[model samples]
Target: MLDLLEADRAFVAENEAQILDLEAQITARQRWIDLLRDAQRAAKQRLSSYKYPVLTLPNEILGEIFMHFLPPYPDPPPLVGNLSPICLTHVCRRWRDVACKTPSLWRAIELHPSVHRLSNLGETLSLIAKWSARSGHSPLSIRMECRRQFDPISIFTSLIPHRARWEHLNLNFGSGSYIQTLDIDRPMPLLRSLTLTVWDAVGTPLPLLEVPLLRTVVINDQGSPSLVLPWSQLTSLTLRRTHPGACLSILREASQLLECRLHLWSQRTPLGGGAVVLPRLESLVFERDSEVCREFFESLVTPALRRLELPEAFLRPHDVETLKAYISKSGCTLQSLRVTALASLIQQILYRMAFRSIPTITFCE
Candidate 1:
């Protein structure tokens, strides 16, 4: 009887030990499950934060912000896709969507090929076409500059088809062989302002650029036979490094011209002996290369001229006296005079002008 009792006791002890081991295993598993659930909740919260936040901005505010990223009109600044994409798009999806939809934000298309490659020419043109189409009949101002090798004829031809949509055209051909190959015969009926910098003297005679609404014309080269200025409505004229003889002819034709800028280089020819009567002229700018500025100044006969900008060069006492005498005699309404020269010569000129009580003079050294 005692052996049986001992055997029962041993069996009970073993069973209890087995049950406790099972309970510990169950507890460890429950702990693991709790840890897994906490991890899963944290992951869900992180994913939710990553989801795009809703932006509640008015359309006009969004438009204005996008406009800040846009290029100025009448002349589109260069676009590198860096600012609009990387800077703005990275902020949020709403910003990306707004940037993508703002047509004016993308309307500025720059064709200056120096910053882009020839392979990109097609892409650039396509971009311009897209922007013009998106502008919805709004007049476009196109600035095309080619400083390296390019097909000027091809470029001009491509733009000719869109001439009716062009409001302002700025062409800079600084260093390129193709500059001479441009075909300017195509008329830009809607062109209001034209700026041309021709490095090469090639191109067919420009057709009558008879934009009756044209107001400003800037030609920065010796007058070329290929270029025929439509001067009937020209109000502002700027001639930089131009042939003196041709410029005189242009001035004579632009009888109603109001503002004039003449930047004469050393190699430019002196104006011929003639009296140019600019009856309505108000401002005259003379940026000279040497003392020969006197010759260029003497060529003009502007009775109503009010401003004079002299060159930065050493002038003898006699030369200063001569300039003062000339201004005293002709420029009765000369209100402002800006003289630029070396320090010593400028002081001497100022002293002479002051002694004569010539109208206010500003010296630039």
Candidate 2:
């Protein structure tokens, strides 16, 4: 009986040992299974990130995408709107970091300061300062239009500090009060395009000879004599609300002009001078003055002229003959002609036949 009992005990002990060994093996396998599951989850996360590139795109790549979101540089987006770069800051934290660090995004600014509203001026100035700060050392394109009310000096004061970066600047004011406050006497190294317009002429002339890089200019009647431009260097010029004499005088100096647009204030061609010969002039647009622009038309000799726009009245008493003579004199192969028609059907037909050699001709009444 004792031997049988001892055998039973030995058998039980062996079975217990086997059970413990099995438990140890099971625990090891379970640990490996858990580790594999953790690794699989991490890999899945990586795959999802790859699928959505914005999630994993480096900040530099994201910044480039942000740049495409705004208008091209030198053309400003609104200071505050969906189109504004400021909208990018409202996104995730990472995106905000990327946008704030991109200088080009904040380089252009457009401001309209209403004199009627005294309240918004402060806010506008704040935004201008903010953009200036965010732009870093990048060149600036600034446009400001102030209507009716005087004194937008504060706005000018804000921008005067960054004059070195003025690339494409356009300033329009209701009166000339703002012109004196414009501290543009300092050199604008990067200034390429400039537009300055005001209603009443001020004694203070805006001498902009310091802008060596200036190529394009647009100014009004008040701006004509008041602003001294680097006329010879200009490639494109637009003069609005100017006298015939003044217009001719400017054209005489702008010898390098490839394109010119003149909106004459009167038909009186006061001075009898030689034709304002522009050898390189390619396009000429003469917006009708109060009277006929016949004399003005007779004044230009552009050999390189390809496009001409003027009133039919400007072609004068002998329209076809005048145009034929003008074309002959210019030695220009006019590719396009646009005429503001105020002529009878017979006259129009004759004009059409006369200019049939021109590749494109359009008439608008």
Model 2: lDDT of residue 23? 96
Candidate 2: the clashing residue pairs are: none
**What does the lDDT come to for candidate 2?**
0.84
Candidate 1 Cα misplacement greater than 4 A, ranges: 1-54, 83-93, 117-119, 147-150, 174-183, 266-270, 288-291, 312-317, 345-360
Tell me the whole-model lDDT of each prediction, alpha carbons only: 0.66, 0.84
lDDT of 1 by residue, 1-365 (tens): 99999999999999999999999999999999999999999999998777332455665687677677655676575645564322565677777667666666655556766565435557656755655665566676777776445555566567666677677877776543344455454566777777877775654555545576777888776334547777757888888786566667778888787888877555345567686677788888776453344555656677687776776452344656666566555654777777766467657556655545546777666
Clashes of each: 0, 0
Q: For each candidate, what TM-score against the reference?
A: 0.73, 0.81
Model 1 TM-score, 2 decimals: 0.73
Roughly what TM-score does model 2 have, to 2 decimal places? Answer: 0.81
